[model samples]
Target: MEMESDFYEAALFHIDRERKLYSSMPSRHYHNGYEIFYLVSGDTCYFVDDKAYQVVGGVLMIINMNEIHKLVNSSGETFERITLEFKSEFIEGIFPDNSSIDIFSSFTKGLPMIKLSGQEQGAIEKRFDTMIHEYTQQPPGYESYLKMLLFELLLFIYRKMESNPRPALNEANLVHKKIFEIVDYLNRHYDEQHTIGQISKNFYISPSYFCKTFRENTGFTFTEYLNNVRIKEARNLLTHGTDKISTIAESVGFESLTHFGRIFKEITGMSPLKYRQNYKV
Candidate 1:
């Protein structure tokens, strides 16, 4: 699907894993939006931030904006999920003064996997059904109604979490701690040059070990993750300004316009200017 650039946006989907082997790996990437992933009927290993999660059916994984994540097909079983993504702009537009409360609390460090009871699942599913119907029908005032439905869905999950909090993730292991530290470093320094060897030296690990561990845990090579971060930021600039595309590329760490244009087109399927023209508010 092409990238969505609306200030207020929502989508619903049903996926069936019939064509591919469960061992087919998923790409690691991030977006400028919150993500709610509901496993409908599936089993997969989800790698988010610095930890791996074994996700099964009837569970929801909430990911905050710009958090790197991917789903790996570990078991060859039938896998399906419904994913919803909306930008913070969407949330803020709906709840101008109350968006903070609507956010999933400490989503980055907390256990984001919410296992729903049968009744709760049915309620959430019904909300999703209504959302799909309203979105597809696009009747009068559907945008406002869509926003209301999204808020209701989020409220339901928030109440479920408050009523039954999951235990915090155990990050006592030295390796996990180090990995998180590396992730933090990257998030802070994505505009700067980063290399596997340099990062390994900073983290006091051999380059080979760092490569293996990073891929195993985050499902991304250092360079791949860095490019994704840069591209995401570039998209933000494109949407918010009329800056010269070359300047935006340089600001986001791409060294040359040629290279930046190639990567931009590769990820977004549109030239930077085209994307801006399409999405500019």
Candidate 2:
């Protein structure tokens, strides 16, 4: 079962309960607003930027805007989750002017995953239930009520994090640890030229095994992952810098302008020039 609500483009809420295993993970992507993901049951692997987390039931993952992430099932168990996404404007004026707190700071600082205790999880579940009810029923002032509920939820999490910080989740296997290290390396050096064989040699693993493990853990082949990292950086440059398209292409590790244009369009659904025109500030 799945339920979803979109509030005037500023916020979105979704709940999904799946009884069967997912044949494939969702495509890697990022959002324009902050994302709050609560795993209600089962287990999964969550990749956020450079690190991969072994997320289980009762874990909440916060992803900042434009941070690349993906979730893959870790086992054949059924799973359920609730996701809330909201732009900054969605909760504007909720905070007092003199307050020193930034409720959403968790999205930017510290570990992205939070492990909630049984009691804490119950509290959060109640807030989600209320938000869902208000959204579905559309009672008087339901929109405002929903916003308040979201604010309360975030504040509760923020306070919990402040009072008792949890350690980061460890990789479940040695192979996963090594693959995540490779992911970190790739994230930092995406603009440099690389080859699977070279990376495997540097990381002290057989090329074939590296390819298999990388794909299994990250849901992307070596080449695909490299291209994604490079393209992700390329997108940032296109949006924030005044570099020429060819320069941007080469800087992000594409050897050929034509190839860059082709891949850029393939991944982003538009030519680089068009993307720049639409998104450049």
Predicted structure with the largest TM-score when compared to the true one = 2
Poorly placed runs, candidate 2 (over 4 Å): 1-20, 23-25, 165-281
Report every candidate's CA lDDT.
Answer: 0.65, 0.71
TM-score of each: 0.50, 0.54
Badly placed stretches (over 4 Å) of model 1 are: 1-25, 96-106, 168-281
On lDDT, the leading prediction is 2
- Pairs of colliding residues, candidate 1: none
Candidate 2's residue-wise lDDT over 1-281, tens digit each? 53222223324554333334562336567767888888765556777765777555557888887787778764645556777778877778866682788888877775677766544655676688688788777899987887788888888878867875654343333337667667767765778889988998899999998887776654456786677657656876998999999999999899999999998876666789998997788
Backbone clashes in model 2, listed as residue pairs: none
Task: State candidate 1's TM-score.
Answer: 0.50
